[model samples]
Target: MKEILERRYTLTPFKKEIKGLKDAFRRASLRNLDSMRKRGFRPKNISYYEEVILGEKRYEELKGFSGRIIGYFCTFIPQELIYAARAIPIRLCSGFYDTVLVCEEILAKDICPLVKSSFGFKISASSYFELCDAVILPTPCDPKKKLIEILSDYLPVWVLKIPQDKTSSSKEIWLEEIKSLKERIEDFTKTKLTRQRLEETIKLIHKRQTLFRQLYEIRRANPYLMGGRDFLLVIQTSFYDDIERWIDKTEELCKQLSKEKTHFKTDEKIKILVTGSPIIWPNFKLLNIIEDLGAEIVCDDLCSGTQSLYNLVEPDEPTTDVMLGAIADGYLLSSVCPCFIENNDRIDRVLNLIEEFRVGGVIYHSLRLCQLYEIESHRLRLILKEKKIPMLTIHTDYSQEDTEQIKTRVEAFLEMLKR
Candidate 1:
């Protein structure tokens, strides 16, 4: 019965169109993939993320139970609201290069790769997004803010206005937006966001993030217990995978990791904190280079990494209002995204993390056309310079043309940090 329901739910009405798009994508992607492999850019979590992409393992099992899957893009959109409404929230951000060619044809050639891939995967009827009821996107960056207009033509879309300022005025405005989002969600699912349901869901999400932080804690205290690649796999998986199941497995890993002893002293390896644009799974270019150099990424400020685990919504009361306030306060106010205007907190947190994690330097990576991160890089540079911290910022796209260039720069950065 479960298998039948899953097959039925995922079956697309526009099968012919979907098939043709996918077939075209495969041919174009194979050529690029061969070159990428030749450049030695294999993703660290290929098997796991591939399974997640295909929706064949855990994602399949969960979608087997229900069809109310809500696809979301950024961490700014809370999952607890969807969970509280008795729907599965799956992250729909795309880091897959295979769809980039197909995407570039439809969208502008210079638009961000992430939007292109995500929109392409949707139109192509990819397994992960085929059955979603709606997509919730926050207007954080310019590309993302404009993306909803195009996406709404295909799917039921909800947009949340992310503030450009951290002022008291913006906080109040954002709180109202959260309220509007809740009402929109309620309308979409035909389910009311009750106090009891919201509280229970908040607890579940809180537990999940707590366990995620515990994994990071192990890495911070004993970097040998968890490598950079393995740590990121766990972090990225939580965005779309079943929250409760991910929590159980992460806690189990945390338990096993906690029992392990550090074979080497803290000074044995160069610890680093990574920041800038989100580096989703299968795009582990920066992580691959950094970890390959014997440096451990003790922490990061990426949405796909530590930022997802950075804040906890410690509500004094588990009421819906309190939990909503907590989510707004923790996820938005505490965020380090370059989209915000008054963003000194982002650089301040970087310096604090450098001291806390004893990070040797910061590697700030930005994808092409991502102006916010590149602009923020200048500000972050001034702060790092004053603090006398070594840093490097890399800019590139999905193509592996600049692999050697980045490798040389990373080697130089590591050497500088060592001296």
Candidate 2:
């Protein structure tokens, strides 16, 4: 019955009018990149991250690469498995508002902008979507579950079923799913995922996660050593950047940060912690406004931010089954995504970040039509209120139509925090 419904949705005719989207998207991307570049105290090695974020260099490099490219949506898909299979994993979550407009022709006007932008890139064959030999999608939400059907029409789509409840039975089910995913990836890459290769990849990703933690620690410096927008760009680049290169570049950036000293006093700027929906690059309106108003975003609870790198895969043994179980636990159990029915983990994470970062205020960014975050915000707000921590929920979409309005509201929130 589910398959029947998916097939019906897949039959919708899509007229791909992609004539000017590429150039338009490029201009918008560069414009946003330049805007971020001109702000705050930027590190000398920041260009390395900028180039990676732009993706032109990586795109050229991949064009001549020998391995198959596998694109996946959501961090739930284990990248270590993709590496073990000798396939490159590229995250397909997009933040381009122009692509959202392009997608509106095919999708409903009220769909989540992130989903629309991602599908838009695929339909137009823009960005790295054209390079993907296959794509893996996790069924974490209704939009993404339906997305698998529409995306199947464009490329080979593999669905990774995510169990909503974090129970022992669910863990067992997820482990089986991980094993199934490993088999599918091996078939796609025509490479056997040996125990040695999986272990090697797990260790390699652990190195990358370690570097991310180092950068996170650097951000914890008094008076703020780095701006949140810059840190976010660095994290977002990990979506497509080479793992080894990303680690090296990030380490270099961290070392540069360590040698520097900030003249900005801690009391001069309010330290704000941003939580809720992922704030992908190029759609950094909320972040830009927060910092431009003189508040430092010391920490965040965003999946696109700290949550993606906070957990490590610690297998009890180097055996493949145990390693896969560890990866399953790392992704599912540690995740605070609102998709789960019980997400007190998210509240706890928020309170912890507030205390750790000395957050003066909390900003909950809810993307329009993203029901999960919007629904979760109410409970989050109530909990934050009880703790006497202030939280401002900004509900918005990808378009700049609400930019001034958001800026105004954020200015008011920062003022209240000061008082």
Candidate 3:
């Protein structure tokens, strides 16, 4: 019993060897800075990403503070509730290549790389990982579901259930689940979820979402002003750091974009909408190759991209029940994940983004072993065919060895699109 409990929270001998991996992750991200600069991306505007990507800055700041810090995997987990309980909720998703290599040895080499990277980071004792008082994991897909089962063996894990479909009946069930999660959060933090506090948190997060929406709109309206790489980094950074600062920086970025009449010759570049598994920062190989091959990703429906921030939490009534219900429904209805099969939410999102951005082509990127997204790409292909929009689907893993192959395919697709 003592051995099992000890193993649940600490590391094994191999994981201990990589305890201080902050520099490794930073070096990996900085590998592309020169290329980004050559492409005219603003380095100053993205300084926050470099500062907090490894969690050293925030961890240092909060080291003396006595408060619970919850790490969660999916966006489906309601962050407002965590904030309401006076606890911080940080996203624990991963994109580090070294960490994924470490995880593959223990968690099977064939699973999703994102899941492996996340678990590997946790086991490696990242400062951000160390600050996690608990982990809230939700099962929107199979890899994540199994990942949490393995993660619970090493860390304190709380599983939050979500509905697989967007039926009225399922939405009601999701509401109950949200309420249950609130209770779990409250139990963890020993703080009560008061009506006033819940309302305040909801408005606070909704305000941030509104600014994020503005940034999303400006990307399509002014593609030359911001590239997909910077936009994705900003969004990914917001997942794990200070929410207010993210809002301010995003607002500042949009303000600068709206004022500047940045223009680029669009005759050669095909406007494309990318949809697939979450592409976190530093893993921007696909976007880089697409743009390099003469395509402008004006907007994307990917989980890590713009689609997650589309819905606002608006309560029909000024009550805790109504507010919680609104928050739960917003995620259920606006979610772009293909995990929701009984409805056409994913199709609706893709078609809407394509029309809204005037996207000429769709690049459906399904990461290897991510069965749900891969399965849904076929349906999206049929839907795009009916609409007479061109598309290319690519199944890829998180390795740069396939970069040349992906770039070749993207180049060929761009040629067809231009014709």
Q: Which candidate achieves the best TM-score against the true structure?
A: 2
Worst 10 residues of 2 by lDDT: 1-10
- List the pairs of residues colliding in candidate 1: none
| TM-scores for the candidates | 0.87, 0.95, 0.92
Residue range 1-419, candidate 3, lDDT tens digits: 11112333544334544744778777667764444555654535677665666466777865665898889886788888999999888888877778887777777788889998888887677757677888888888888887666776566777777787787898888898788888888877889999999988898999988888887767667676666667777777777777888788777777777776445435335788888888876677788888766577778877777765667888988798899999898777787777776547778878988888788899988899899888888888898899999989888877888999998999999899888
- The lDDT values for all models are 0.74, 0.85, 0.78
Tell me the lDDT of model 2 at 388: 96
Better of 1 and 3 by TM-score: 3
Q: For residues 1-419, could you state the per-residue lDDT of candidate 2 as single tens digits?
A: 02222444445446476787767766767877766766667888988888887777899988877889999988798999999987899888888888887888878898989999998887777788889999999988889998988887777788889998899999899898888888888877989999999999999999988888888887776537778888888888998898888888888888888888555454457989999898887788888888878888889978888887877988889998899989999999989999888999999998988888888999999999999999999999998899999999999988889989999999999999999
Ten contiguous residues with the weakest lDDT in model 3: 1-10
The runs of at least 3 residues in candidate 2 whose Cα sits more than 4 Å from the true structure, single-residue gaps closed, are 1-17, 261-267
For each of the candidates, the C-alpha root-mean-square deviation to the true structure, in angstroms, is: 6.6, 2.4, 3.5
Candidate 3 residue runs with Cα over 4 Å from true position:
1-15, 41-44, 62-64, 262-268
**Poorly placed runs, candidate 1 (over 4 Å):** 1-55, 264-267
